[model samples]
Target: MSFSITLVIIIITALISWRAFQDNDLKYKMMFYPYNVKHHKEGYRFLSYMVVHADLMHLFFNMFVLYNFGQVMEYMLDFKYGSSLGTFHYLILYIAGGLFATLWPMSKNADNPNYLSLGASGAVSSVFFAYILWNPGATLNLIILPFWDIPAWLLGIAYLAYEYFMAKKGTSNIGHDAHFGGAVFGILYVLLINFEKGQAFISYIFN
Candidate 1:
């Protein structure tokens, strides 16, 4: 399928979210399917939640990052892991990252019934983080700062650090906890799974 298909799917999510918010149905909360008698009958809407976004800006940024990183990762993993394993891994990380994002926040605020969030930023960040791990010395220019230059791996580290502090202090409106948790899971999961393969990568470089 073309990437535009993914874009279209995301746009549909934005429209639904907008309409739901306008209608003032509290049932429209996008993060976890809030436990309700009706939703309970449906069961496990976690995967569906990945496609939903709170607004236009939210949808754009998530799709932008996914478009940039996901296609390349998808191709590489397809070759390395075979099409089936590759697709499975991609799905695993994508869903796991979002699920973890929600879990990390909810873990601390389990009793805070008002807490709600939605977006694919945390999951896309995982893909971006993993890409950097596999391509360690690649360069990534900071678009916001423009003049800043850094190695891809280092950039990922810096992002994780910022997320850590922000999450710790409850400093901003952004979901820094999701960012940090997803990144950690990405780096650790890739390294742990490919430990032998990674050592071989190093040995080939030296030899």
Candidate 2:
């Protein structure tokens, strides 16, 4: 149903992101740095980085996506997994999703002291993919492109493809690589844990 946990996360992230906007030192402290995690023992950045965003736009976009998809995923999980386990697992899905999303980058760029990243894009991507998996036919109207009510599955494929294209160009500041990885985790995590339910969803979507 209308879940509380996702709202709670939005509130916390908003507060942190807002405060970080006013304080550059705080922003730097909360940002994820692979080098710092390995050498300086700043492991907590894995979680902290999700709360502190680069700007209001970044925070708004992420929380907006999470609000739409996370609530759906939560309600669906409640039906199959029960509310208690569903909420608990949702929390794990988010926090662990954020943590796990960083592993690939950390491993690849651990030596680069200047490399830093932040925001909830990784975990939010996971939630978005989960919603896409559970409801392929449902449509989403992007705020910027409200006229195009694209099906979630097509949107997902395009989203990943766009991320891959952007990652190759390296022109945008967005972490497209993490977004891609997080999306993969989102789809796999749900199917891996609930293969029968996933199968049911797939069957319903196609038939």
- Whose lDDT is greatest here? 2
Best by TM-score: 2
TM-score of each: 0.78, 0.91
Candidate 2 ranges beyond 4 A from true positions: 1-3, 200-207
Q: What is the number of backbone collisions in each predicted candidate, taken in the order shown?
A: 0, 0
Tens digits of per-residue lDDT, candidate 1, 4-95, equal: 33344346656766665565443253455434213344224444456566666877788878887777777777778987777777777766
- Where model 1 places Cα greater than 4 Å from the true spot, the runs are 1-27, 33-48, 196-207
Question: Which ten contiguous residues of candidate 1 have the minimum total lDDT?
Answer: 34-43
| True-structure lDDT of candidate 2 | 0.85
